[model samples]
Target: MKKKYKERSARFRFWRNIAMFLPGVIVAFLIGFVGSDHPIEFQKLFDRDMLYIGSIILYLIIFGIASTYLFSSRQSYQMMEATEDEDEAYRYESQTRRIYDLATIFKGVMIVPYLLVIFFSCQKLIYEEKLTGILGKYTIPLTFLGLLLLTFGLEHQFRKTFKQIYGKAIPRNSSGAEVRELIMSMMDEAEKQICYEENFDIVFKLSNYVLPISLMAIFLVGITFQTDILLALVVVSLIYVYILVSQYKITKRYYKE
Candidate 1:
C-alpha cells in the first residue's frame, strides 16, 4: 500500500509540475515565433523614465507597509508583555507572529524594487553616455549605498523584534555551524522535519525549473533588447557553478569515508 501511495504521489507531482510549466513554455514559444521576423522594440514598449519613477514609488510603498507591520508587531509584543491574562497574552503573541510574518514578506518584496531602481540608474548612465558627469558617476553607487543602509536598518529592526518575541538572538556575524546550532536549538523534531522538507522543496524547484526558466528568460531578454549576451552568459555560468559546487560539497559530506 505504501509503495502504491508513493507511486501515486510521484505521478501527481509529475503532472502538477507539467501543468505549472506548460504556460511558460507556450508563452516562450509564441514570443519566439512572433518575434522571429521582426525584432521587438523594448524601448518603445517600456518607458525607462516611467519604470525608474515607478520603482521608486513601489519601494517607498513597500517600505511603508513593512514599517507598519513591524510597528504593529512591536505593539502586540508590548501588549503581550503587559497582559495579566494568560489567554490574552497568547492571543497577542499569535498576533505578533502574524504581523512579523507580514513584515518579513514585505522586507523581501522591497528587494525587487530596490534592484529595479539600481538597474535603471545604471541604464541611464550607460545609455546617455553620462559616465563622466558628477550625477552619472555617483548615481548608481550612491543609490546602492543608500538603499543598502535602509535595507540593513530594516533587517536590524526585524531581528531585534524577533529576539524580543522569541528570546533567540541570531548573531549578526555567526558562522554556518553556529547559525545551524542556533536554529536547531529553537526547533523541535517536528518543526525541524518540516524545515528540512520545505528546504528540499525549494532546492528541488530551483534546480528543476527556476534556473532553467531564468536562463531562457535572460536569453530572450538579451535577444529582444539587443543587449550584450555576455551578461546573460555570465549569470547563467555563475548559477551553474553554484549548483555544481553545492552538489559536490553535499556529496562529499554525505559520502565521506
Candidate 2:
C-alpha cells in the first residue's frame, strides 16, 4: 500500500510539474510586454538589475517551498509511525502536509514574475544595470514578513487543535508511551484543520520555510550583488549547525532517560 501510494504521488508530481511551468511561461511573457515609449528612468524599474533581484527572490521562494515539503514530509513520517490511531494519524498527516502544498503553490505563483525578471535582466546578454542589494530595497524584507506571519499561525493552530483530537487533558500521569500517544493525537488533530490563509498558520509555516531559504537567498543575492558573501555563508552555516546540535542533544537526553 505504501509503495502504491508512492507510485501515485510520483505520477501526481509529474503532472504537477507541468501545471507549475505552463502558467509561469504564459505570465512571464505577459509581464514582459512592456510599453516601448517609456523614458529610461521609467523603464529602469523593469530593467536588468531589478529583474535579477526579483528572479533571485522567486528562486528562493521555490527552494523554500521544496524544503518545507521535505521537512514536513519527514515530520509526517515520524509522527505517523509514532501515532496509534489511524484516523488521528491521517488528520495529523494531512494538516502538516497541506502547509507544504500551500507553500509550493505560493512559490509557483512567485516564479512567474521571476522568469520575467530573468528575461528583462538578460536582455542585452550582460549584467549591465545596478544590482540592488536585498537590504537596500524592501521587497525581500516584506516577503520575509509574510513568511513570519505564516509560521506564527502554523504553530498556534496546531496547539489550539490539541483538545479536540486528543483527550481533554494530556495524560500527565501515564506512561511515556501513553503520553507520547496522547500528544501525537492532539498534534494530529491540530494538523487536520490547518489554514494556510490564517495569520498565525502563515507565521508558523514561515518559521520553518523562511530560515533556510532566507539563508540560501542571502548567499545567492549577496553574490549577485557583489556584497558580503562570506558573512551570509557563515551565518547560515552557524544557524543550521546550531539546529543540528540542538536536535542531537535533545534526542540523546530523551533516550538517556
TM-score of 2: 0.31
List clash counts for every candidate, in order.
Answer: 0, 20
Model 2's alpha-carbon lDDT is 0.55
Give candidate 1's TM-score.
Answer: 0.70
Indicate which candidate wins on TM-score: 1
* Candidate 1 lDDT by residue in tens digits, 1-257: 11333445888989998997787678767767766656666766888778877888889899989999999999999999999999999999889988998998999899999989988877877787655445657866776787789889998998899899889988988899997898689778987887787887787788777887787777767666556678667877688668757988889999999
Q: Candidate 1: where are CA atoms >4 Å away?
A: 1-38, 41-44, 125-149, 168-181, 221-227, 252-257
Q: Write the per-residue lDDT of candidate 2 for residues 1-257, one digit (tens) a residue.
A: 11333446777978987785575456445535642343234344464555656666665666566556546655665686689999988887676656545544654465465555546545633443442556444544464555546444543443333333232654435688986666455554445445323544554444455665676566445433445468767876786666556667758988996
> Candidate 2: where is the Cα deviation over 4 Å?
1-41, 45-47, 126-257
lDDT for position 109 in model 1: 95
